[model samples]
Structure formats: C-alpha cells, structure tokens
Target: MASKVMMTPGEILREGELEKRSDSLLQLWKKKRGVLTDDRLRLFSGTSERAKELRFHSILKVDCVEHTRKYVYFTIVTTDYKEIDFRCTEESCWNAFITLALIEYQNRRAVEGFRRHRFQRVASEEQQEEPGEQRALSPW
Candidate 1:
C-alpha cells in the first residue's frame, strides 16, 4: 500500500513565481504565481483568484524546450493537445518541480486503478465461492 502522503491529493508540493508565455496573438511573457499541488498546477496573477488551472488528469506531459544561461524553458502539454509555455530561473527549477509532481500524480492514479481492479476481481471471486453454492457436475 502506498503511504498516506503519496496517495493523498490536494497536498501542496511547490509554490513560486513563474513567467508564462501568453496564448494570444501577441504571445508576450506574463508573470504568474504557480502553485503545484498533488493533483494540479494552478496559475494565478496578482489577484487572489486563479487565472488558469492545469489539472493532472488533463495534462499529457511536460517537455523541456530549452535551457539558457538565465532561464530554463519548458512546455506543458495538455490532454486536449494545447501547449502552454513557461520559463523560470534555473535555480528556481519550476520545470523540474512540475515534471516531478506530474509524474507522482500519474503514479498515484495508476496505483489507484490497479487497486480498484484487484478489488473488483477479488469481489467477483468471493461471489463465486459464496456459502451454500454448489458447482454443477459433468454430464459424463
């Protein structure tokens, strides 16, 4: 069984400021407060409310675009096929944080799925072995 900390969702893993590339035509760089949780990565502006959310369930993968002297660039690819670009200082390691969190989320999901499947199989087997139930004999 997985530990409580690894299995639990909604736990805050990392939080910091990151610069994201805008999705509009101008495609300018905008600052965002990024929060990496066990299940999702949320981006917020100066306001208290979240501006954008990329849930782990909807995220396909995170890829490194490039790494420069000052910044490490990366992209978050969503399940819907949308690409979101971001960059942060090399020391900050925003990209690494997100990638690790995403991997952990995926692992948790896989563990849950395996557990559910195993439980269902066990329950089905138990039903077949119910008390007072008898197996049919061969005609031969």
Candidate 2:
C-alpha cells in the first residue's frame, strides 16, 4: 500500500516560500483546471507511455469508478506510489486517465522549477556582491 498525504486547498495556498525542488504548483495553477492544464488546448495528450511505466508499480491496478462533469475518481491499488495523479493505463486501455497522481507530479515539477529559479537569483546576486574567494559560499 502506498502512503498518501491529503492536503486541503487552504493548506496548499498558505505556503509562503518554496524549498529546493518544492511545490510551486500553486503558481502553475493559473490554468483552467488548476495545476493540470487542459492538454487539449495545449495540443498535447495528458499522459505519455514512458510516464506510465516510470510512475506505476508493476503490481499496480487501476479501475475508474466514475467520470462525471466535475471530476473522475479512480481506485488505484499499487505497491509504492508517491502522491501523484493521472497515470497512463496498462494494456487494453487507451489515452491517459485522470488520477491524483498526475496532479502531484505536475505540482512537484512546477514547484521545483520555481525553487531552482529562486536559488539561482539569490546565488547571482551574491556573486555580484562578492569580489574575492568568499564568493564560493555566501551565508545570505
């Protein structure tokens, strides 16, 4: 069984700063469906075959319970899954499916990028200020 962390929208909104490789998903959520942008408009499919093989465990099994106008819930039984949404299905199933897994992955990636940019900006400023060997490490 995979461990899951259920966070409310309020909790996600309260993050003040992003850590290295952290959650910048909130920024990415400027799209229509929050973080998971409509790939149809982006002219891309939501899921890729490699993403499925890499994300899903060998023993993983998914069954879609409902696909309504609002949201779709998929009951996924897996061995070890990091908190993510919308993974590709196995044989006999076509196209990507909606699951929490894909949302999590996109969120993580977006956050990580934001953090990396933040660090880069900080490091650049430090480099501009320091003129000697002290440039190697700036406590600030």
Candidate with maximal TM-score: 1
lDDT of 1 by residue, 12-61 (tens): 88888999999799999999999888888889998778458889999999
Give the TM-scores of the predictions, in the order they appear: 0.85, 0.30
What lDDT would candidate 1 get against the real structure? 0.89
What is the Cα-based TM-score of model 2? 0.30
The window of 10 residues in a row where model 2 has the poorest summed lDDT is 13-22
Worst 10 residues of 1 by lDDT: 131-140
User: Which residue pairs in candidate 2 collide?
Assistant: 24-111, 84-100, 84-101, 85-99, 85-100, 85-101, 85-102, 86-99, 86-102
Model 1 Cα shift for residue 72 (angstroms): 0.7
Using lDDT, give the best candidate's number. 1
The C-alpha lDDT values of all candidates are 0.89, 0.37
lDDT of 2 by residue, 10-124 (tens): 2321111111111356523111112222221111123322221223222244556555554443444445743223322243121233233444545666799999999999999
